[model samples]
Target: MSQGDAQIDFYPATQAPIFRENWPRMRSHAIVPRSKEGWIDPVISEWSLEGAAWEDFHPHAEYNYVLEGELHISVDGEEVVLQVGDSATVPAGKLGRYWAPKFARMLTVYGPNPDGEESTDFKYEEL
Candidate 1:
């Protein structure tokens, strides 16, 4: 490898830093860490859930692809069930709720960081 040369980055995504830390029913394996230099995370993660649910909104967009089982998602109260090999995109600033019954395995992508703006944490509003 030489200075100024582009290098391929490899992640041992299936090993170490194992999932299911605090959120018992939910597990995540991060492919890219959240960015401190953007309004979006620029992150990719593999996630699994069993009988779990969560809700939030972000200033940036979010995408979810189901690899196995099913993922239930609601964007602004419109519900969609993502079956195996299905995907969904939640536009920027919309409230989203994600969950799974039985089990689900999926990949999640966040943001393009188009403007390179500072990121803000997830938000929520009372129903």
Candidate 2:
């Protein structure tokens, strides 16, 4: 997919790649490829973590929607616990930590990506 392609993309919720240690041992799969569409830059992915935690700073705003289990996010000096069907947005540049006590599945969206393909670089970091 590329800019001006203007084609619909369908990625099944259950369609996830092999679990990889992308975030401090947490697993994630990139659902949307890196691309530029006009002035918009977006990243989409499915993530799951169990008994683990990870933290990072995003240069772009991030929206996380819980799909199953629960997710606990600590940002801006507060702990935001999101259960199934819950959603939350972390402001750009905020240090956010995500913790899954037992297990959690989520749909994540990061947008207005200021760094293009590098916007979601955290997913590939060795950390």
Query: Would you list the C-alpha lDDT of every candidate in the order shown?
Result: 0.74, 0.74
Residue runs of model 1 more than 4 Å from their true location after superposition? 1-6, 15-22, 39-41, 114-127
lDDT of 2 by residue, 34-100 (tens): 4553226567888877777767787778899999998989887899999999999998877788888
Total residue pair clashes for candidate 2: 0
How far is 98's C-alpha from truth in model 1 (Å)?
0.6
lDDT (tens digit, per residue) of candidate 1 on 1-127 = 6878978778765732324355566677778766556644368888877777767666777899999898888986699999999999988877788788777888889877656544344332222
Q: Extract clashing residue pairs from model 1.
A: none
lDDT of 2: 0.74
What range of 10 consecutive residues in model 1 has the weakest lDDT sum?
118-127
| lDDT score, candidate 2, position 121 | 24
TM-score of 2: 0.73
